[model samples]
Target: MDPPEQLALREVFTAACRAQRAEVLATAVRRFASAILTNLAARPVADLLADYFKPVALYAICELVGIPATQRAVVAESAETMAASMDGVLDPERRAAAIGSRTALSRVVDSCLRSSDGSGVLGHVARNHRRLDVPRSVLVHSFRLLLSPGYMSVATAAANAFVALRAHNLPLTCLSRDTGVDELLRYCGPVQALGRLCRSDFDFRGTPVRKGELVLALLGAANRDPERFPGADDIRLDRRPNPHLAFGWGTHSCLGTSTARLVLSAAFGRLADQFPAAELVSEPRYAVRAVVRAPEALPVRLTRGSEGAIR
Candidate 1:
């Protein structure tokens, strides 16, 4: 990477840390938390917990990437259809949503770039984008990157942790507090897998990996690597020096990762506080998909909990 590129990334990182990234994530967290709470307060029997995590994550991602309101639905729809197409449900709505989302996201990013003021990530990314002459593909790439956090891995991790919590007679309420969320992320593998494309020839152990090939980094596998963690499968909430790779490493590292952690911390903290006695009544099933693999749908009865109105 050139010095200019390095400088650009550094600037963006600095700007991201300056509150834009945190703000975007906090906004998302608030929306998601409110959505769930509203549902709880209004509905009588609310239990499609994991599924509820998806749309909030999706909409938040759109806003973060500056996906134009005109095309936000399309981008969301297209991405969903693209995923579903592999499963044989290529609906026309998804196609339209995708195409529109891409277009809108592209335009909004452009507007953001032209207005750079070191004031917002939008302007910062725009200034750097123009300086770098970023391509349209980056818009799609960024959208995809931001899309996963709220609903997919982060939510799955929460669900899986919920399962583990119940199986061990642990309280879901503990998660709502600030205690043990980081350990939960480390132990549960919030992001089940991460991917990399070889930019240069490099050797993995003994095998030579040439440029332009896909490399799958199994975060779940690495987190469980015995040499790295003793009794790898065990969950030790007090575990330290974790060195877990729930978030990828290097330049292309996940931009929203810290933000994801914050959102999760808040959500789980609330869960711990609100439903201290909730219990799971069904066997949780896991799902596997390209790039991300883990539980897709988590169902629970909330069998025993505070006498709060659950939506």
Candidate 2:
């Protein structure tokens, strides 16, 4: 998208995800996270990614985008299908399935817009669609963009965080602080890279890039750059002055940054406070995706803690 159109659409998303809406989403996330953890605590073992994190993310995004409760299950299924297709980028069958799923999702977005009653992000866009400079199709695509990352990316990030926590034997409480959350985002962010098209020719330390060439920013590598982040290999929960690009930088940054942060912070903070004794039951099975790397399943055994008893 051109700068003007991008800026205009971004304004709509920004308004939808402002402070007031974020607080409401945060409260909902905390409640949902607590309930999920409590239910998992009752089970001998649970797939944290499938049962807990995925559901939490699905609920948050659906609510944020005004997906009706009746349609959430269908949306979640399509979203997962789309996420699975990412790993099979080379396979024609998967690509076809992804296209089908995307179309289904788009239809849902259209439905929401048609029935919009001034609620959620879809409502905001629908009400102002006529006034916006961008085409209606573009707005619909943008809504799809919002849903994909808000759901899949957030779930994957949480799973990655748990993997890191288990590997390092870090206390769940580490996620309670903003600094710790930032460090977690740096170390375990699910987005492996950001892809862009070069608009103009440029040189990077002698390497030249021409206009229209594809450029990939390796976010995972940059986050671990030893020169930029001292002891970058280690997960320091309280790392200060950590300016990481886990979320892409500049104008094309992730549109749901605020929403993702609120969900992660609330969900993890609730886990830390209520289920400190949670442990991974086995090695996580990762999904096959190059762009948004995350575990397909995270088996966990939640034990009762002194502070938060398992009921």
Candidate 3:
């Protein structure tokens, strides 16, 4: 993506956040949680992620971007294909698929912008595109970015948070306090690590680093470091003064931190409240991706008569 495109995309999110357009994100969270309940109706329990969260996240993203339901599957497939290329481990066939999907996704996003159902972040951007002077390609790239990480991260984070809550057997009320949520975010480390290029020579403890070298900050390890966080190995529900960098730190920290927290808290909080007896039927099967890590399957047995049935 070119600088202009990047800037325009940045503006879209920054502007949306500035306008306090969190209601859309909140609705998406509720819809995601409801999907889990819907799946439970068919089966006593299902893969919390694959069976429910994935589809819900995909649908919620489309809803957020004004992508019509009719075109959602195609758009979603394209976005997924494109995202698979991000870890830079694509074979020739996969590379070709990524390129093709990028083309298709760009076209689909262009169509949506032209005739949006007229709502959500995309709608706001479309209405202000001329004012922002953002190019069609820029908007398309932005949509792709939003659809992939913007959706996947929140869904995966919520699932992981629930897993932590289950492991610790903590109550939903714990998450009501900000400290509880912070510890959850720290313990989960959804993004895992961030790669940074050294601009100048630096020394670490005893080892020396050269300029222009790539270094991966292992956020998950850091968050679990006992030195920084006492009893870090244990999931302290109300771990306070937590300086965990789950959302990354410094200049390029995640822009969606607040939104992500709200989504996770709302989703998991409801799950805990509704299915207090929900128990894991099997171990979580995680995706093998190194860059962004989350469980592919989280099988759980839910209580038969849960209060918060999807209405």
Candidate 4:
């Protein structure tokens, strides 16, 4: 919280988090959207998620972060295994996985820094860190900050939205407006929780939270709270003023909010347009991971105009 660190934060936002990077955002969207549609069109009966959405998420995020093609699979695998540790269950296996992933990613990020071509987010952040007065260590950690959830959350959120759409028999016309995408994110966002370390003693609804304590905020529960959102349990496609915390609030809010919105809008919009009559072939089983609420497998039957394919 020094002046230099604050400046660094502002610089990072300016460099990589702006909404006007429409060309890059559009490319990421098109790459992933086309991949998803191609995979679906070819093998309609397969796990719509496994072969398409997950890879799309990984590739899009990596493209943004400038993660190399050679390192992507390892990074993706480690990041996913690391998510299991976020359930607040630090069993030995989970802890081991998380440690291994952190170490591997840190090394990869360091290598990326060494070869910085002054392109992409990672390169920009790397080149400007000294000017921003940000520590190299912090810049390295930012890799995980950007990549881990960037892949997991976007993929999960998109998949969850698809499931909700099919389950409720909501048609593709719903996504014609931005409100539609916002409501879908609120109803079925990927993140289950957000964690923070208490910096000082505080009262929460008359309960005392001591400093040095770890607090896990249940974002899913908050988004579903009926008091804040009437009919919170239901998907209200046109719900305006939806201040849902699918992304975190305040200074710690998601830096990629603009990019995520564009990616998702493009994703669901394409789904609605191309496969207007996509249907769930079976119950969508969620992954057992604690932090990210994504489908383990999504078996959906896609209808091209009038012809339907089975799972």
TM-scores of the candidates in the order shown: 0.72, 0.93, 0.79, 0.90
For model 4, the superposed segments whose C-alpha errors exceed 4 Å read 1-7, 88-90, 306-311
Best by lDDT: 2
Per-residue lDDT tens digits for candidate 1, residues 6-92, read: 566445545644545566566666667666755664444445443444554554555555554565565555454444333223255
Candidate 2 local lDDT, 222-306, one digit each (tens): 9999999999989887798998997677887877777787788887788877667788877887766677788878988876564
Worst 10 residues of 2 by lDDT: 302-311
Candidate 1 has what TM-score?
0.72
Q: What's the distance in Å from true for residue 214, model 4?
A: 1.9
> What's the C-alpha lDDT at position 58 in model 2?
89
Model 3: ten consecutive residues of lowest lDDT: 302-311
lDDT of 3 by residue, 167-253 (tens): 776655556556777887788856777677887899999889989899988888999998999988887876778988876665455
Summing lDDT over every window of 10 consecutive residues in candidate 1, give the lowest-scoring window. 81-90
Pairs with steric clashes in candidate 4: none
The per-prediction CA RMSD against the true structure, in angstroms, equals 5.3, 2.6, 4.5, 2.8
Overall local distance difference test of candidate 1? 0.56
For each candidate, the alpha-carbon lDDT, in order, equals 0.56, 0.80, 0.69, 0.75
The alpha-carbon deviation from the true structure for residue 20 of candidate 4, after best TM-score superposition, in angstroms, is 7.1
Regarding TM-score, does 1 or 4 come out ahead?
A: 4
**61: Cα error in model 2, Å:** 1.4
Q: 89-108, model 4: which lDDT tens digit per residue?
A: 64667876688888888888
